[model samples]
Target: MKKIKIIILFTILLLPKLVFASNATIAITGVNTAAVGNNIKMYVTLSSSAAIGSWELTLNYDSSFLKLIGSDADNGGTFMANKVAGASGINKKVYTFTFRTLKAGNTLLSIGSSSLYDFDTMGEMTVRTYNKNLKIMTQQEIEASYSKDNYLKSLSVDEFEINPVFNKDTLEYSVEVPENTKTINIKAVANDNRSTIDGLGEKEVVVGNNKLNIVVRAQNGSERIYILNVNVIDKNPIEIIIDNVTYHLVKYKEYLTIPSGFEETTIKMSDIDIPAFYNKKINYTLVGLKDEAGNIYLYKYEKNKYERFLELKLGNLKLTPLSIGNKVLNYEKETIDFDGKIDVYKIDKRFKLINAKNILNGEEGLYLLDIVDKTAVKYDLKDIYTLRKLNKIYLATTIIFLSTTALSIIIMLSFKRKPKIKDKEQKVKEKTKKELPKDEKVVKENKKNK
Candidate 1:
């Protein structure tokens, strides 16, 4: 009994030394924290001093918290399959296991009863064991760490003072620089450290108004925009003449109204870039023209010529005639009692007027009559011609049919009654006998009786 106790004590002491002397180790490594519904990957690595013949291990994890999705085994450059037995001898190997986090809790992933065989002796080898602990977080916890502050704490420009002073609540500003200032430096800071800022740094400036936007995006994906209107001075301006009126290039584009389906663009005039709008469908570029009296309007640019885009409003009819060339007749504005405001023009001297499209509603054949009372009419040439021809045919047919009917009525009347000439002759004779004397009348009557 004493010898048995000693042998057991010696064995217990030798077991600790054998464990400590292990030259091979197996470990599991992955991210320590994850959110629910997130897929995470864990690596199982086996490291040994010498190459081993094979290895076997069973994975242990909480099924309720982590669901195994996929796995891949790698032995050096070669791939080891998931099956238990295979032609395998490796010094180093790694198994990648992917798991989808299902619940919010602390979970443990460990290896159970792992064994490695010696490559030369085909005997078992001792290896140190390792495990991984991960914390799965709820959505509320994830949201708590994110910031929703999208405001800018401060904003400034280099070598210039922001207009109206810089305030966190003020999102708009204006800055004026010299004529030669080609670029300006902008700096913006977010209210929260977790937020991100864009559109900060060197910005290109134009001769006139330059609109720069500084955007701040929070960690929660919220955003805010700050506008900086930078105006570079123009000492010498471009001037143009239109219809005996002097107009200048517009400096501020905010006063202009952009039309639909047109995008903002730029045009070069005298080597200077001018803000313009272009519509590809119409193939037209319109520039903002400012008059001497500070009135601004949109004018079409064509072959270095500029003309006011005419928008005529008469009664409820709005017309935007093609004003480029002879598409419209030369007219003077007249006040008609019926139309309130109308354009009186002579279409008789011009070619068949074409290219006038109604702006309000799509209609064809627009004309201005120079008659007693001037008015606008919508007509189709082909339809008008057909209608006129049909009207003439109807009128001639009615006239011929009525004349034949009247002649037939006269013939029937002659056949149904005595002749007007005989009746008139009899009446004349009777009158003459009556006028001669009562005795002559009696003698004439007796002769007739005999």
Candidate 2:
């Protein structure tokens, strides 16, 4: 009994020494806080002063809040994997594991009973132990593709109405496109920050039905869908695009009225006139072109003709055409008749004669009329001025009259001074010829002095 007591005391001291002097240790290391829905890494290090043969450890964690992804048996480069035991073992061996945070909570992870076979000792060695904690947070959920926020079409024209199909708690809908639409645009919206969307947006509208599918993803990795069926109708068969503006052609259409641009002006539509025979017997097709600056041009074509016979540059024209047997049209109280041989055209706002700006633009309103059928032009505007032709003749007559009048005034002054001058000259000559004119010379001198 005394010997047993001595051995027991010695055993206690030996155990303390062994634990303190150990050259091998194991620790549980991982993130203390993990965000919800995020991945985390856990590590276990087996460090020894010397090489080891093998090691095995079982980690325990709260399974409710954490999901284990996988582990690297070989520590990704630090240790050798034990294939038979399905573990890692080596000097300085490290094991790494990945996990996902399932919910918002706190959890503890610890290393269970483990062993390390040391090559130098050729036996199992003891090592230290540790525990770790983790936490997950709750965040707002993601949302996508709200049915109330998604729209398949947006148009401003009042001619078409938008009425989607009504269903029982379903987001699917449909819309009808107006006829003669060459192109169309669509709009779709995602209403949540955490949501994602794909497979839906603006798309071209074909002549038939167009299918629209929009996918929405939430923060929780859930998906929803919004489907739209758009029906596009067939438009007028004869359509044309000029300067980005579209015009429709109608049957038996002779003249297209271009509304006046100015709100108030003295120019009345009846004030303008086109010849009755302009479009009497021939067919006429009319189309309009608009530029970015708001200038409108009308292209006139003969019936059954593809090419344009006339293009109005500016302003507009009004032609009250009289058809065959049709009453003579009244224009400014003037009688006119349509021979039914050619169609008469009336321009509204784009008449170059009414709008002088067309002249600056180098545009002629009657250019089309000149090229079509060699039709004769009755009259045109001529500039007027006063005395333009008689200016040179008037200037010459004035110069000749002024010269003759000056000569007559000079002759009259010379005749009035001639008598006095001749009397004085005769006295001087008689006194110079006679020597006994001393007294007369003195008297002449006195007269001259006076």
Candidate 3:
């Protein structure tokens, strides 16, 4: 009797702890100290020796001191970490609550409500939570400094804005400048207070790239470099000198005058006829012209004729000279025109063939053409005899066929069959039920008999 009384008393005393131990718990697990507007994460975990099927957690914070930003299950992940469980229950599952300090004050982060279920899927016990207090401090003000902050804040020249570019957290700066600007005055400033910046003045730029180095020295003698990747693009390249003589480049409105000896690049030209007609001094563009020989010429249009503009040696090209006189001008620099006295010109490779074909339709005519494209040129001569004979034969055949058709039509019209006079055959009109319904003596449908 004495041992039974002692055992019952012990069971009664240990019943509360055993029951409370299985109850769910909640806590704010983050840094105790926080700055103003700093965010803190709080965890509310419900754990029981039994398996958990599902749960819902809720937190209430002091609205005056802290502002609740967000609440999530395991920081925006799924509620269940390993959905397929090997064991019967989850060991620990956390519910996250994020809050930001609104004012520099202490706030109590408490679990206002929570519910949990075991593997049996029943909420039988009351849930308990541990409350937490957060100490939030005022935010520290950022001090203005020369070296510590953003380097190369503002880069500019007189009346011109130079965009200084740098990689994130990089100390170097690079900029591109106009070509016409020979000397540029750059203004640069540092954000750090104690730092001193050197080489922030006038810099002479070369034709291509001009590299300028700026040194930033802080008060502690810590040196940093703000490299100026200054790219001074070369100006519109005007004159190019060959040997000692500098050939001045003359610019017209559209095209450019290519130098005689050297090569040049300019806007593409079209519409103008090559092998110009006469030496009429037209106020044409002072641009250059190129021939088949790859010779670029710049000359006054008044002194320029079709062939006299440039001396092109058509090496493999078949060119027919306009005149083949006794002079026999071999390796000629000046090109001759079609002879007006004799109207006869020799054909060499295949230039200016007077009777070239318009290969599209086989019509022969004179057409200026690009040597690279020879589709329009005549490759085979047309057979005139065969064409004429074929035409005569076709005309005779057509005339004979038409005559025979006309005779046949006339004979058929004359021997046509005359219609017999018994053509008035009449069709009978049948009376319907409406016409017969007036009288009672009418045949009825035999539906009943059938």
Best prediction by TM-score? 1
Q: By the TM-score metric, which is better: model 1 or model 3?
A: 1
**lDDT of candidate 1 over 392-414, digit per residue (tens):** 99999999999999999999999
Candidate 2 contains a number of clashing pairs equal to 26
Candidate 3 off by > 4 Å: 1-21, 73-87, 121-123, 140-450
List runs of model 1 lying over 4 Å from the truth.
1-40, 45-58, 73-94, 111-133, 137-141, 151-175, 181-194, 201-203, 236-298, 301-450
Model 2, 137: alpha-carbon shift in Å?
Answer: 1.9
**Alpha-carbon deviation at 52 in model 2, angstroms:** 1.9
Better of 1 and 2 by lDDT: 1
Clashing pairs in 3: 145-191, 145-192, 145-193, 146-191, 146-192, 146-193, 147-192, 281-302, 318-349
lDDT of 2 by residue, 1-450 (tens): 999999999999888544232357887787766678888898977788766666666777787888877777544322333422324335676678788889887788877767767664446666777778766666532122222332222222124443553332356666788654534454444565556666644455444445666676655566767666665654433444544555433211122343222111111113332211123223333343323222233444344332322322323433322222222112112121222223333332221111111212233222223322323222232221245336667888999999999999999999999999999999998887786677787999999999
Q: In model 1, what lDDT does residue 415 have?
A: 78
Model 3, 17-62: lDDT tens digits are: 4333245554556777777777887776666666665666556667
Error of 1 at 224 (Å): 3.0
10 residues in a row with least lDDT, candidate 1: 333-342
